[model samples]
Target chain A: MRTIKLTLNGTSVSREIEDNRLLVEFLREDMKLTGTKESCGVGVCGACTVLLDGTPISACLALAVHADGRAVTTIEGIADGDRLHPLQESFLRHGGFQCGICTPGQILAAKALLDANPHPTRAEIQHWMMGNLCRCTGYYKIIESIAAAAGAE
Target chain B: MVPFTYLEPASLDEALALLAEHGEDAKLIAGGTGLVNLMKQRLVRPDFVIGLRAIRALAGISEKDGLRIGALATIQSLEVSELVRRHAPLLAEACGHVATVRVRSMATLGGAMAHGDPNLDTPPALIAMDGQIVARTRRGERTIPVDRFFTGYFGTVLERDEIVTELLIPKQPAGSGTAFLKFLPATQDDYATVSVATRIALGADGTIREARVALGAAAMVPVRARMVEAALSGKASDEKTLGDAAPLVVDAIDPIADFRGSAEYKREMAVVHVRRALVEAAAKAKEAR
Candidate 1:
């Protein structure tokens, strides 16, 4: 076991986690921050995407111990109290999701993209969000949502 | 994942000491993109998992005599690095092609080399550029040419107590041009059906001064197409010359039949892609000249 202190969302938290515990498990099981989903245990799918030090990474492939002394942002951290983040609002406004299993990850991944490039083009949005799979939306709506979010910003 | 005591070493010396102490019982974890998946699959069950992220010294890209890339530098960082793009754009292009942005953010270049996956895009680029793997043990350090770094599938010559410290890529010749082509018939992120990286340098006389050809996903180990390189050296930088040399690549690669392609199909694709890469590289070389 190891004690890892990290900035989650905006608040700092310390926890004693198993050495083998993945970042996804730490967020969902221990912290009850189930906003990050783990659909593909491998790194191929971005369902478990979370921002580590302001960069998106596969939580399932990242160990909790690696989060030590770093900042991690998840989907739960996206909203501002009652007010939803612009990306979240844009997703809703554009009908970005269908089944919604990939919504959280999609939002977080898009959040990272906008944070890096506030005004990404349609091609840029497609390239960045390609890893976050949405079986229902066929990706056009997701692209629309992200582009709308970028424009709104 | 099997339970293991995680060790975080803050310094390279400490990490080397830990490796020496644990020997075969310990496994080093870098970006965790590769090692973590192996652990989850129960392919590796190390008693002690050494975390290398804490060693801040082993991170960053710097240009000395050549480009010196620290092992801990993330693929994303390398892809965006101005120095990398300016000096070795083929490497930057290869780094950008890996998996996705998320994987690139977490996967380290050193970890990629140590993982020794034959299908990875970086190895061929490294080999074509004459990159060297700088590995270190408690005793000393040694440089292994990237082309000879991988021993077999998922294997390298790294010792049980050794760690890859950095990758050293020498400067390309003045009239050199390089190309990295990955044939992905499936998803953009999927491993290549046949990947080719080629570097062509033209002499002032317009003959091929030197040539380097390397391939990935075309063999159990990243193949350095020495035969193809030999065929191109001193030859005219023309379509026919490149076409003749490209077929010689078939003698170097022994691809396995899988969902990506049949062995024979991969061989054919290898020849075609190598020729295309050569042609593109030759055009760039002419422009550079």
Candidate 2:
């Protein structure tokens, strides 16, 4: 087992675990932070996206041990107490989801994109969101939700 | 996925020791795009995963006289980098065409090259740029020029207990232009069927001095067409010359058949991409001159 300490959601947490555990498993099974989903388990489906030191990455592909000394952000961390993040609110208002399994990943992916390029063109948004696939919504509403949020800011 | 013992080495030396101790049973996990997919397929059941994400050696992009891209630099980072866009535009070009935004965010430069998947886009482009692979183990570090790095189908000269640390691309001598083009991912879970990378060096008189033409998914490893290179050498930069040389480009290739296309079809498309890439490269070279 290895010990890892890192800031998650602005709180520093330390834990000891086997080295081979996947970061997604550690977050969901150990920490009970279930906001991050695991869809493909192979890094293709973006359902496992998390911000590792401010960049979005598929946590499923990263070992829990690698998260040592690195910062991580999940969907649970996106909200301000009871108040939802603007991106989350936009996702809700714009019907950015259907079954909701892929929403967390989609929302985070959008956040990363918008944070970097606050006012992405429609085509830029589409290209950036290419990795995060949402099967139920066909991505029309998701793009609109992002465009609306970008416009809001 | 099969059960495995995992270790996240605090330093490169620690990682190399772990790799040396485990040998073939140990595999480095980065970005997880390639290995995790293999795990899902039960194709690889590594008993030990030597995680390098924490090691400082395998991250970030810095430049000197030439571009120095850390092997662990995620494709996403590479695509968004101002340095990459300015120094090695073709790198950004090749990376942008990879799977999608989400995958790029974590897929490392090292993992992609070490995996040596022929269908993957970066190898051919790097090969054309005369890229070099930097690898390290507990013993020491060494470099392999891109052309000498790949051995065969899904094979690389990277030794056990070694991890690729960086991919160094030398500055293009002034008066050179590079272009990379690829067909979309038409097959399920496969690399691009045909991808082409062309680098053209023009003389002051606007004649072609030297050219590099490489194709991926057209051979066991990404192949450099000697015949094509010879045809372009010392030739005037013109449409007819590149067009005439396109067919002979495949003389050096021996493609394998898969669901993407028949071997014959892949070779024919290789000709098309090579021709297209050459024409584009020639035009860009002329513009640069």
Best by lDDT: 1
Candidate 2 clash figure, as a count: 0
Winner by DockQ: 1
CA lDDT for candidate 2: 0.85
Q: Please list, in the order the candidates appear, how each scores on TM-score for chain B only.
A: 0.99, 0.96
Which residue pairs overlap in candidate 2's backbone? none
Q: Supply the TM-score for candidate 2.
A: 0.92
DockQ of 2: 0.51
Clash-forming residue pairs, model 1: none
DockQ of 1: 0.87
Per-residue C-alpha lDDT of model 2 across residues A1-153, encoded as one tens digit per residue: 778898888899999987667889999998999989998787777898898887888888777776788899999998999999999999889998899998999888888888889999999998877778778879899999999999998
Cα distance off (Å), candidate 1, residue B204? 0.7
Q: In model 2, what lDDT does residue B50 have?
A: 74
Q: List DockQ, one per candidate, in order.
A: 0.87, 0.51
